[model samples]
Target: MNRTKILYSAAAFIAFSFLAGVTLQHATAEFVPEWVKNTAKWYGEGKTSEVEFVNAIKYLIENNIIVLELDQKKTESKTSPTFENIIIPNGNSKVGNVGFYIPLNLEIEKGTTVVWINDDNIEHTVQSQDEKGNLISLFNSDLLRTGERFAHKFNDDGAYHYFCTIHPWRVGVVTVS
Candidate 1:
Protein backbone atom coordinates (compact mmCIF):
# COMPACT_ATOMS: atom_id res chain seq x y z
CA MET A 1 0.00 0.00 0.00
CA ASN A 2 1.07 3.62 -0.52
CA ARG A 3 1.85 6.11 2.25
CA THR A 4 -1.44 7.96 1.63
CA LYS A 5 -3.52 4.77 1.94
CA ILE A 6 -1.70 3.80 5.13
CA LEU A 7 -2.39 7.22 6.64
CA TYR A 8 -6.05 7.09 5.60
CA SER A 9 -6.50 3.61 7.08
CA ALA A 10 -4.91 4.75 10.31
CA ALA A 11 -7.21 7.79 10.47
CA ALA A 12 -10.35 5.72 9.80
CA PHE A 13 -9.23 3.16 12.40
CA ILE A 14 -8.83 5.88 15.03
CA ALA A 15 -12.18 7.42 14.12
CA PHE A 16 -13.94 4.05 14.30
CA SER A 17 -12.25 3.32 17.61
CA PHE A 18 -13.51 6.61 19.00
CA LEU A 19 -16.99 5.85 17.65
CA ALA A 20 -16.91 2.36 19.18
CA GLY A 21 -15.98 3.80 22.56
CA VAL A 22 -18.99 6.11 22.50
CA THR A 23 -21.53 3.72 20.92
CA LEU A 24 -20.54 0.35 22.39
CA GLN A 25 -21.96 0.88 25.86
CA HIS A 26 -21.81 -2.86 26.62
CA ALA A 27 -18.32 -3.25 25.15
CA THR A 28 -15.90 -5.14 27.39
CA ALA A 29 -12.18 -4.50 27.86
CA GLU A 30 -11.52 -7.54 25.64
CA PHE A 31 -13.28 -5.83 22.73
CA VAL A 32 -10.65 -3.11 22.39
CA PRO A 33 -7.19 -4.59 22.61
CA GLU A 34 -4.43 -2.23 23.75
CA TRP A 35 -2.20 -3.52 20.95
CA VAL A 36 -4.61 -2.14 18.36
CA LYS A 37 -4.20 1.41 19.70
CA ASN A 38 -0.46 0.94 19.82
CA THR A 39 -0.51 -0.37 16.26
CA ALA A 40 -2.58 2.62 15.07
CA LYS A 41 -0.28 5.10 16.84
CA TRP A 42 2.82 3.40 15.50
CA TYR A 43 1.36 3.31 11.97
CA GLY A 44 0.34 6.99 12.08
CA GLU A 45 3.81 7.90 13.44
CA GLY A 46 5.50 5.87 10.66
CA LYS A 47 6.78 3.25 13.10
CA THR A 48 4.70 0.26 11.93
CA SER A 49 4.11 -1.55 8.62
CA GLU A 50 0.90 -1.20 6.61
CA VAL A 51 0.13 -4.91 6.98
CA GLU A 52 0.15 -4.67 10.78
CA PHE A 53 -2.26 -1.70 10.77
CA VAL A 54 -4.57 -3.46 8.32
CA ASN A 55 -4.51 -6.62 10.45
CA ALA A 56 -5.48 -4.65 13.55
CA ILE A 57 -8.46 -3.07 11.74
CA LYS A 58 -9.47 -6.47 10.44
CA TYR A 59 -9.51 -7.89 13.92
CA LEU A 60 -11.82 -5.15 15.21
CA ILE A 61 -14.18 -5.52 12.23
CA GLU A 62 -14.29 -9.32 12.50
CA ASN A 63 -15.20 -9.06 16.17
CA ASN A 64 -18.23 -6.86 15.28
CA ILE A 65 -17.08 -4.06 17.57
CA ILE A 66 -17.03 -1.44 14.78
CA VAL A 67 -19.63 -2.22 12.13
CA LEU A 68 -19.09 0.14 9.22
CA GLU A 69 -22.33 1.19 7.48
CA LEU A 70 -20.56 3.98 5.60
CA ASP A 71 -20.32 2.03 2.37
CA GLN A 72 -23.98 0.91 2.53
CA LYS A 73 -25.30 4.39 1.84
CA LYS A 74 -27.88 4.48 -0.99
CA THR A 75 -28.57 6.95 -3.85
CA GLU A 76 -26.26 9.52 -2.24
CA SER A 77 -23.27 7.25 -2.66
CA LYS A 78 -24.08 6.30 -6.27
CA THR A 79 -23.46 9.56 -8.14
CA SER A 80 -24.51 8.15 -11.49
CA PRO A 81 -26.59 5.26 -12.85
CA THR A 82 -25.51 1.63 -12.48
CA PHE A 83 -23.54 2.05 -15.72
CA GLU A 84 -21.24 5.01 -15.01
CA ASN A 85 -21.65 6.60 -18.42
CA ILE A 86 -24.82 6.63 -20.54
CA ILE A 87 -23.92 5.04 -23.88
CA ILE A 88 -25.45 6.60 -26.98
CA PRO A 89 -26.24 3.17 -28.43
CA ASN A 90 -25.13 2.17 -31.94
CA GLY A 91 -27.63 3.03 -34.73
CA ASN A 92 -29.33 5.44 -32.32
CA SER A 93 -29.74 8.31 -34.81
CA LYS A 94 -30.91 6.18 -37.75
CA VAL A 95 -34.17 5.27 -36.02
CA GLY A 96 -36.04 6.85 -33.11
CA ASN A 97 -36.76 4.27 -30.41
CA VAL A 98 -37.91 4.29 -26.78
CA GLY A 99 -34.56 2.96 -25.58
CA PHE A 100 -32.55 5.46 -27.61
CA TYR A 101 -30.40 6.26 -24.59
CA ILE A 102 -29.03 3.26 -22.73
CA PRO A 103 -31.06 4.02 -19.60
CA LEU A 104 -34.18 5.96 -20.55
CA ASN A 105 -34.61 7.68 -17.17
CA LEU A 106 -32.06 8.24 -14.41
CA GLU A 107 -33.23 9.11 -10.90
CA ILE A 108 -30.55 10.58 -8.65
CA GLU A 109 -30.13 12.83 -5.66
CA LYS A 110 -29.12 16.47 -5.70
CA GLY A 111 -25.45 17.39 -6.24
CA THR A 112 -24.96 14.40 -8.54
CA THR A 113 -23.20 14.76 -11.89
CA VAL A 114 -24.36 12.79 -14.96
CA VAL A 115 -22.24 11.98 -17.98
CA TRP A 116 -23.39 11.25 -21.56
CA ILE A 117 -21.02 9.76 -24.12
CA ASN A 118 -21.62 9.56 -27.84
CA ASP A 119 -20.77 5.95 -28.65
CA ASP A 120 -22.33 6.02 -32.15
CA ASN A 121 -20.68 6.77 -35.48
CA ILE A 122 -22.77 9.88 -36.16
CA GLU A 123 -22.72 13.26 -34.34
CA HIS A 124 -25.00 14.20 -31.41
CA THR A 125 -25.71 17.01 -28.97
CA VAL A 126 -26.93 16.92 -25.32
CA GLN A 127 -29.26 19.79 -24.65
CA SER A 128 -31.75 20.34 -21.82
CA GLN A 129 -35.31 20.87 -23.03
CA ASP A 130 -38.77 21.49 -21.54
CA GLU A 131 -41.84 19.24 -21.77
CA LYS A 132 -43.05 20.92 -24.96
CA GLY A 133 -39.58 20.55 -26.58
CA ASN A 134 -38.58 24.16 -25.85
CA LEU A 135 -34.96 24.70 -24.78
CA ILE A 136 -34.65 25.17 -21.01
CA SER A 137 -31.12 26.62 -21.40
CA LEU A 138 -29.92 24.67 -18.35
CA PHE A 139 -27.14 22.94 -20.29
CA ASN A 140 -26.11 22.42 -23.93
CA SER A 141 -23.19 20.45 -25.29
CA ASP A 142 -21.28 21.08 -28.50
CA LEU A 143 -21.72 18.70 -31.46
CA LEU A 144 -19.97 15.54 -30.33
CA ARG A 145 -18.61 12.86 -32.64
CA THR A 146 -17.82 9.23 -31.83
CA GLY A 147 -16.32 8.61 -28.37
CA GLU A 148 -16.97 12.21 -27.33
CA ARG A 149 -18.62 13.03 -23.97
CA PHE A 150 -20.61 15.72 -22.16
CA ALA A 151 -21.16 16.06 -18.42
CA HIS A 152 -23.31 18.20 -16.15
CA LYS A 153 -23.69 18.43 -12.38
CA PHE A 154 -27.28 18.83 -11.14
CA ASN A 155 -27.25 21.06 -8.07
CA ASP A 156 -30.95 21.86 -7.95
CA ASP A 157 -33.88 19.46 -7.47
CA GLY A 158 -36.07 18.89 -10.56
CA ALA A 159 -36.70 16.64 -13.53
CA TYR A 160 -34.24 17.43 -16.35
CA HIS A 161 -35.42 16.47 -19.86
CA TYR A 162 -32.57 16.31 -22.32
CA PHE A 163 -32.60 15.47 -26.02
CA CYS A 164 -30.20 15.25 -28.93
CA THR A 165 -30.52 18.29 -31.16
CA ILE A 166 -29.69 16.30 -34.30
CA HIS A 167 -32.16 13.52 -33.45
CA PRO A 168 -34.93 15.18 -31.46
CA TRP A 169 -36.62 11.84 -30.85
CA ARG A 170 -33.55 10.50 -28.98
CA VAL A 171 -34.30 11.78 -25.49
CA GLY A 172 -33.46 11.01 -21.84
CA VAL A 173 -34.54 12.38 -18.50
CA VAL A 174 -32.65 12.79 -15.26
CA THR A 175 -34.77 13.39 -12.15
CA VAL A 176 -32.76 14.93 -9.31
CA SER A 177 -34.17 15.34 -5.84
Candidate 2:
Protein backbone atom coordinates (compact mmCIF):
# COMPACT_ATOMS: atom_id res chain seq x y z
CA MET A 1 0.00 0.00 0.00
CA ASN A 2 1.07 3.63 -0.52
CA ARG A 3 2.77 5.32 2.50
CA THR A 4 0.29 8.18 2.42
CA LYS A 5 -2.69 5.78 2.40
CA ILE A 6 -1.25 3.74 5.29
CA LEU A 7 -0.52 6.84 7.36
CA TYR A 8 -4.03 8.22 6.79
CA SER A 9 -5.60 4.90 7.90
CA ALA A 10 -3.53 4.84 11.07
CA ALA A 11 -4.41 8.42 11.88
CA ALA A 12 -8.13 7.71 11.39
CA PHE A 13 -7.94 4.69 13.70
CA ILE A 14 -6.20 6.71 16.41
CA ALA A 15 -8.73 9.51 16.17
CA PHE A 16 -11.66 7.12 16.42
CA SER A 17 -10.16 5.38 19.45
CA PHE A 18 -9.58 8.68 21.25
CA LEU A 19 -13.09 9.89 20.62
CA ALA A 20 -14.61 6.61 21.78
CA GLY A 21 -12.67 6.73 25.01
CA VAL A 22 -13.66 10.32 25.67
CA THR A 23 -17.32 9.53 25.07
CA LEU A 24 -17.26 6.59 27.49
CA GLN A 25 -15.49 8.60 30.17
CA HIS A 26 -18.01 11.45 29.94
CA ALA A 27 -21.05 9.16 30.07
CA THR A 28 -23.26 9.44 33.16
CA ALA A 29 -24.07 6.23 34.95
CA GLU A 30 -27.02 5.87 37.31
CA PHE A 31 -26.13 4.96 40.89
CA VAL A 32 -29.39 3.85 42.51
CA PRO A 33 -32.19 2.09 40.68
CA GLU A 34 -35.79 3.31 40.37
CA TRP A 35 -37.22 0.50 42.49
CA VAL A 36 -34.84 1.35 45.30
CA LYS A 37 -35.92 4.96 45.16
CA ASN A 38 -39.55 3.91 45.43
CA THR A 39 -38.84 1.62 48.34
CA ALA A 40 -36.82 4.23 50.18
CA LYS A 41 -39.62 6.74 49.76
CA TRP A 42 -42.16 4.24 50.99
CA TYR A 43 -40.30 3.37 54.15
CA GLY A 44 -38.22 6.46 54.88
CA GLU A 45 -41.26 8.70 54.71
CA GLY A 46 -43.84 6.20 55.96
CA LYS A 47 -45.16 6.83 59.46
CA THR A 48 -43.94 4.07 61.71
CA SER A 49 -43.13 3.93 65.39
CA GLU A 50 -39.79 2.96 66.85
CA VAL A 51 -40.75 -0.70 66.82
CA GLU A 52 -41.70 -0.50 63.16
CA PHE A 53 -38.54 1.39 62.36
CA VAL A 54 -36.49 -1.40 63.89
CA ASN A 55 -38.53 -3.99 62.02
CA ALA A 56 -38.16 -2.05 58.80
CA ILE A 57 -34.41 -1.93 59.24
CA LYS A 58 -34.40 -5.66 59.68
CA TYR A 59 -36.53 -6.07 56.60
CA LEU A 60 -34.20 -3.90 54.54
CA ILE A 61 -31.30 -6.07 55.61
CA GLU A 62 -33.15 -9.24 54.69
CA ASN A 63 -33.79 -7.90 51.21
CA ASN A 64 -31.51 -5.25 49.69
CA ILE A 65 -27.95 -5.08 51.02
CA ILE A 66 -24.85 -4.56 48.86
CA VAL A 67 -21.16 -4.57 49.80
CA LEU A 68 -18.96 -1.79 48.47
CA GLU A 69 -15.63 -0.95 50.20
CA LEU A 70 -14.00 -3.44 52.57
CA ASP A 71 -11.95 -3.12 55.76
CA GLN A 72 -11.42 0.64 55.64
CA LYS A 73 -10.46 3.10 58.41
CA LYS A 74 -9.32 0.68 61.13
CA THR A 75 -8.51 2.27 64.45
CA GLU A 76 -6.27 1.25 67.33
CA SER A 77 -8.70 1.41 70.23
CA LYS A 78 -12.19 2.63 71.03
CA THR A 79 -11.01 6.21 71.06
CA SER A 80 -13.02 9.30 71.96
CA PRO A 81 -15.43 10.62 69.36
CA THR A 82 -12.84 12.04 66.98
CA PHE A 83 -15.55 14.04 65.17
CA GLU A 84 -19.34 14.48 65.33
CA ASN A 85 -20.63 11.00 64.52
CA ILE A 86 -22.33 7.84 65.78
CA ILE A 87 -20.78 4.54 66.89
CA ILE A 88 -22.20 1.04 66.32
CA PRO A 89 -20.56 -1.77 68.26
CA ASN A 90 -20.29 -5.30 66.93
CA GLY A 91 -22.90 -7.64 68.38
CA ASN A 92 -22.00 -10.00 71.23
CA SER A 93 -23.63 -12.82 69.30
CA LYS A 94 -20.79 -12.58 66.79
CA VAL A 95 -18.25 -15.35 67.17
CA GLY A 96 -14.53 -14.70 67.85
CA ASN A 97 -14.96 -11.03 68.74
CA VAL A 98 -17.13 -9.94 65.84
CA GLY A 99 -17.30 -6.32 64.65
CA PHE A 100 -20.30 -3.98 64.67
CA TYR A 101 -22.93 -3.66 61.96
CA ILE A 102 -24.32 -0.30 60.73
CA PRO A 103 -27.86 -0.16 59.41
CA LEU A 104 -28.11 0.81 55.72
CA ASN A 105 -31.06 3.03 56.63
CA LEU A 106 -29.65 5.97 58.55
CA GLU A 107 -30.77 9.61 58.24
CA ILE A 108 -27.52 11.52 58.48
CA GLU A 109 -27.25 15.21 57.77
CA LYS A 110 -24.86 16.44 55.12
CA GLY A 111 -21.23 16.96 56.24
CA THR A 112 -21.66 14.53 59.13
CA THR A 113 -18.98 11.96 59.85
CA VAL A 114 -19.52 8.40 61.16
CA VAL A 115 -17.10 6.00 62.69
CA TRP A 116 -17.17 2.25 63.42
CA ILE A 117 -14.94 0.74 66.09
CA ASN A 118 -14.08 -2.93 66.16
CA ASP A 119 -14.09 -4.05 69.74
CA ASP A 120 -13.57 -7.63 68.65
CA ASN A 121 -10.30 -9.48 69.11
CA ILE A 122 -10.05 -10.46 65.46
CA GLU A 123 -9.85 -8.33 62.34
CA HIS A 124 -12.96 -7.07 60.51
CA THR A 125 -13.61 -5.51 57.10
CA VAL A 126 -15.66 -2.39 56.25
CA GLN A 127 -17.32 -2.45 52.85
CA SER A 128 -20.00 -0.56 50.97
CA GLN A 129 -22.76 -2.23 48.98
CA ASP A 130 -25.46 -1.36 46.47
CA GLU A 131 -29.21 -1.53 47.06
CA LYS A 132 -29.18 -5.10 45.70
CA GLY A 133 -26.42 -6.35 47.95
CA ASN A 134 -23.82 -5.93 45.25
CA LEU A 135 -20.24 -5.11 46.18
CA ILE A 136 -19.87 -1.48 45.20
CA SER A 137 -16.59 -0.66 46.99
CA LEU A 138 -14.49 -2.02 49.89
CA PHE A 139 -11.40 -1.46 52.09
CA ASN A 140 -9.64 -3.73 54.59
CA SER A 141 -7.46 -3.51 57.67
CA ASP A 142 -4.82 -6.11 58.42
CA LEU A 143 -6.38 -6.88 61.81
CA LEU A 144 -8.69 -4.51 63.58
CA ARG A 145 -7.85 -5.95 66.97
CA THR A 146 -9.73 -4.86 70.06
CA GLY A 147 -10.29 -1.06 70.10
CA GLU A 148 -9.68 -0.71 66.36
CA ARG A 149 -11.60 2.08 64.62
CA PHE A 150 -12.72 3.36 61.18
CA ALA A 151 -14.21 6.72 60.27
CA HIS A 152 -15.75 8.24 57.11
CA LYS A 153 -17.13 11.67 56.28
CA PHE A 154 -20.35 11.96 54.30
CA ASN A 155 -20.55 15.10 52.22
CA ASP A 156 -23.33 14.25 49.78
CA ASP A 157 -27.02 13.94 50.58
CA GLY A 158 -27.90 10.36 49.66
CA ALA A 159 -28.12 6.81 50.93
CA TYR A 160 -24.82 4.94 51.26
CA HIS A 161 -24.62 1.20 51.98
CA TYR A 162 -21.69 -0.74 53.36
CA PHE A 163 -20.76 -4.22 54.63
CA CYS A 164 -17.89 -6.43 55.77
CA THR A 165 -16.12 -8.32 52.99
CA ILE A 166 -14.72 -10.87 55.42
CA HIS A 167 -18.18 -11.42 56.83
CA PRO A 168 -20.69 -10.63 54.12
CA TRP A 169 -23.51 -11.02 56.62
CA ARG A 170 -22.23 -8.03 58.57
CA VAL A 171 -23.67 -4.88 56.96
CA GLY A 172 -24.13 -1.15 57.65
CA VAL A 173 -25.94 1.80 56.12
CA VAL A 174 -25.44 5.56 56.09
CA THR A 175 -28.05 8.06 54.91
CA VAL A 176 -26.87 11.61 54.25
CA SER A 177 -29.48 14.31 53.95
Candidate 3:
Protein backbone atom coordinates (compact mmCIF):
# COMPACT_ATOMS: atom_id res chain seq x y z
CA MET A 1 0.00 0.00 0.00
CA ASN A 2 0.96 3.72 -0.12
CA ARG A 3 3.11 5.29 2.68
CA THR A 4 0.10 7.20 4.10
CA LYS A 5 -2.03 4.03 4.21
CA ILE A 6 0.79 2.10 5.88
CA LEU A 7 1.16 4.72 8.63
CA TYR A 8 -2.60 4.79 9.21
CA SER A 9 -2.71 0.99 9.47
CA ALA A 10 0.19 0.96 11.95
CA ALA A 11 -1.45 3.64 14.07
CA ALA A 12 -4.75 1.74 14.13
CA PHE A 13 -2.96 -1.47 15.11
CA ILE A 14 -1.14 0.26 17.98
CA ALA A 15 -4.38 1.85 19.25
CA PHE A 16 -6.24 -1.46 19.10
CA SER A 17 -3.40 -3.24 20.92
CA PHE A 18 -3.38 -0.61 23.66
CA LEU A 19 -7.13 -0.82 24.10
CA ALA A 20 -7.06 -4.61 24.17
CA GLY A 21 -4.29 -4.61 26.79
CA VAL A 22 -6.25 -2.24 29.02
CA THR A 23 -9.43 -4.28 28.72
CA LEU A 24 -7.57 -7.50 29.49
CA GLN A 25 -5.95 -5.96 32.55
CA HIS A 26 -9.27 -4.73 33.86
CA ALA A 27 -10.89 -8.08 33.22
CA THR A 28 -8.14 -10.29 34.66
CA ALA A 29 -7.38 -8.17 37.73
CA GLU A 30 -8.73 -9.64 40.97
CA PHE A 31 -12.44 -8.82 41.19
CA VAL A 32 -11.89 -7.38 44.65
CA PRO A 33 -11.08 -3.70 44.66
CA GLU A 34 -8.38 -2.06 46.74
CA TRP A 35 -10.91 -0.75 49.27
CA VAL A 36 -11.97 -4.31 50.11
CA LYS A 37 -8.41 -5.43 50.82
CA ASN A 38 -8.41 -3.65 54.17
CA THR A 39 -11.68 -5.25 55.26
CA ALA A 40 -10.45 -8.65 54.06
CA LYS A 41 -7.26 -8.14 56.04
CA TRP A 42 -9.32 -7.35 59.11
CA TYR A 43 -11.40 -10.47 58.51
CA GLY A 44 -8.22 -12.47 58.27
CA GLU A 45 -7.18 -10.98 61.62
CA GLY A 46 -10.48 -12.18 63.15
CA LYS A 47 -11.70 -8.65 63.66
CA THR A 48 -14.61 -8.91 61.22
CA SER A 49 -17.39 -11.41 60.70
CA GLU A 50 -18.13 -13.12 57.40
CA VAL A 51 -21.33 -11.09 57.07
CA GLU A 52 -19.43 -7.87 57.64
CA PHE A 53 -16.82 -8.78 55.06
CA VAL A 54 -19.55 -9.49 52.51
CA ASN A 55 -21.28 -6.25 53.40
CA ALA A 56 -18.06 -4.41 52.68
CA ILE A 57 -18.04 -5.89 49.19
CA LYS A 58 -21.68 -4.95 48.77
CA TYR A 59 -20.88 -1.42 49.86
CA LEU A 60 -18.22 -1.24 47.20
CA ILE A 61 -20.69 -2.41 44.58
CA GLU A 62 -23.34 0.05 45.75
CA ASN A 63 -20.90 2.93 45.59
CA ASN A 64 -19.93 1.96 42.00
CA ILE A 65 -16.38 1.12 42.99
CA ILE A 66 -17.25 -2.32 41.64
CA VAL A 67 -19.60 -2.63 38.72
CA LEU A 68 -21.50 -5.84 37.96
CA GLU A 69 -23.14 -6.18 34.60
CA LEU A 70 -25.81 -8.79 33.94
CA ASP A 71 -27.90 -9.54 30.89
CA GLN A 72 -31.32 -8.30 31.86
CA LYS A 73 -33.16 -9.99 29.04
CA LYS A 74 -31.62 -13.38 29.70
CA THR A 75 -32.15 -13.20 33.43
CA GLU A 76 -35.74 -12.04 33.15
CA SER A 77 -36.62 -14.86 30.80
CA LYS A 78 -36.39 -17.42 33.59
CA THR A 79 -39.69 -18.89 34.76
CA SER A 80 -38.86 -18.79 38.43
CA PRO A 81 -37.90 -15.66 40.28
CA THR A 82 -34.14 -15.65 40.33
CA PHE A 83 -32.35 -14.30 43.36
CA GLU A 84 -28.74 -13.71 44.14
CA ASN A 85 -27.13 -16.92 45.35
CA ILE A 86 -25.40 -17.15 48.73
CA ILE A 87 -21.91 -18.42 49.29
CA ILE A 88 -20.56 -20.55 52.12
CA PRO A 89 -16.91 -19.82 52.56
CA ASN A 90 -14.30 -22.07 54.11
CA GLY A 91 -13.31 -21.46 57.69
CA ASN A 92 -9.99 -19.92 58.39
CA SER A 93 -7.95 -21.40 61.23
CA LYS A 94 -7.24 -17.92 62.51
CA VAL A 95 -10.88 -16.80 62.32
CA GLY A 96 -13.42 -18.76 64.29
CA ASN A 97 -16.49 -18.31 62.04
CA VAL A 98 -15.01 -17.45 58.69
CA GLY A 99 -16.63 -20.57 57.19
CA PHE A 100 -20.14 -19.20 57.70
CA TYR A 101 -22.52 -18.10 54.99
CA ILE A 102 -21.92 -14.68 53.54
CA PRO A 103 -25.42 -13.36 54.31
CA LEU A 104 -26.62 -14.32 57.74
CA ASN A 105 -30.12 -13.05 56.95
CA LEU A 106 -31.85 -13.12 53.56
CA GLU A 107 -35.28 -11.86 52.54
CA ILE A 108 -36.99 -13.21 49.46
CA GLU A 109 -40.42 -13.42 47.94
CA LYS A 110 -42.47 -16.56 48.21
CA GLY A 111 -41.80 -19.21 45.55
CA THR A 112 -38.27 -17.99 45.14
CA THR A 113 -35.65 -20.70 45.22
CA VAL A 114 -32.55 -19.88 47.18
CA VAL A 115 -29.32 -21.56 46.22
CA TRP A 116 -26.48 -21.95 48.65
CA ILE A 117 -23.12 -22.73 47.11
CA ASN A 118 -20.40 -24.40 49.11
CA ASP A 119 -17.22 -22.58 48.29
CA ASP A 120 -15.41 -24.07 51.25
CA ASN A 121 -13.21 -27.12 51.14
CA ILE A 122 -14.98 -28.75 54.06
CA GLU A 123 -18.41 -30.35 53.94
CA HIS A 124 -21.56 -28.51 54.97
CA THR A 125 -25.25 -29.23 55.27
CA VAL A 126 -28.19 -26.82 54.98
CA GLN A 127 -30.92 -28.05 57.27
CA SER A 128 -34.05 -26.01 57.87
CA GLN A 129 -35.30 -25.92 61.43
CA ASP A 130 -37.74 -24.11 63.66
CA GLU A 131 -36.82 -21.54 66.26
CA LYS A 132 -36.76 -24.27 68.91
CA GLY A 133 -34.18 -26.25 66.88
CA ASN A 134 -36.62 -28.84 65.56
CA LEU A 135 -36.08 -29.89 61.98
CA ILE A 136 -38.58 -28.43 59.50
CA SER A 137 -38.26 -31.53 57.28
CA LEU A 138 -39.03 -29.43 54.24
CA PHE A 139 -35.48 -28.99 53.03
CA ASN A 140 -32.40 -30.81 54.17
CA SER A 141 -29.41 -30.91 51.89
CA ASP A 142 -26.90 -33.67 51.67
CA LEU A 143 -23.31 -33.22 52.66
CA LEU A 144 -22.02 -30.59 50.29
CA ARG A 145 -18.40 -30.76 49.27
CA THR A 146 -16.43 -27.96 47.69
CA GLY A 147 -18.23 -26.44 44.68
CA GLU A 148 -21.46 -28.25 45.55
CA ARG A 149 -24.76 -26.40 45.76
CA PHE A 150 -28.03 -26.77 47.65
CA ALA A 151 -31.32 -25.20 46.64
CA HIS A 152 -34.52 -24.77 48.62
CA LYS A 153 -37.79 -23.27 47.49
CA PHE A 154 -39.96 -21.40 49.95
CA ASN A 155 -43.59 -21.67 48.87
CA ASP A 156 -45.14 -20.18 51.96
CA ASP A 157 -44.56 -16.96 53.79
CA GLY A 158 -42.58 -17.38 56.98
CA ALA A 159 -39.17 -17.06 58.52
CA TYR A 160 -37.02 -20.16 58.24
CA HIS A 161 -33.81 -20.71 60.12
CA TYR A 162 -31.13 -23.13 59.01
CA PHE A 163 -27.76 -24.34 60.23
CA CYS A 164 -24.96 -26.54 59.17
CA THR A 165 -25.28 -29.86 61.02
CA ILE A 166 -21.53 -30.22 61.31
CA HIS A 167 -21.07 -26.61 62.37
CA PRO A 168 -24.03 -25.61 64.50
CA TRP A 169 -22.56 -22.18 65.02
CA ARG A 170 -22.79 -21.56 61.30
CA VAL A 171 -26.39 -20.39 61.13
CA GLY A 172 -28.50 -18.42 58.65
CA VAL A 173 -32.05 -17.16 58.34
CA VAL A 174 -34.35 -16.83 55.36
CA THR A 175 -37.50 -14.75 55.38
CA VAL A 176 -40.14 -15.34 52.75
CA SER A 177 -42.84 -12.80 52.01
Best by lDDT: 1
Compared with the true structure, model 1 gives a TM-score of: 0.52
lDDT of 2 by residue, 28-102 (tens): 113323343343334444533434434433343344332222223444444444344334464622646444453
Count of backbone clashes for each model? 0, 32, 0
Model 3, position 34: C-alpha lDDT score: 51
TM-score of 2: 0.43
In the range 54-152, model 1's lDDT, one tens digit per residue, is 788778777875565543456377655332467787788876444478777888777777889888888999999999988778999999999999988
Task: State the displacement of the C-alpha of residue 128, model 3, in Å, after optimal TM-score superposition.
Answer: 0.6
Ten residues in sequence with the least summed lDDT for candidate 2: 20-29
lDDT score of residue 93 within candidate 2:
26
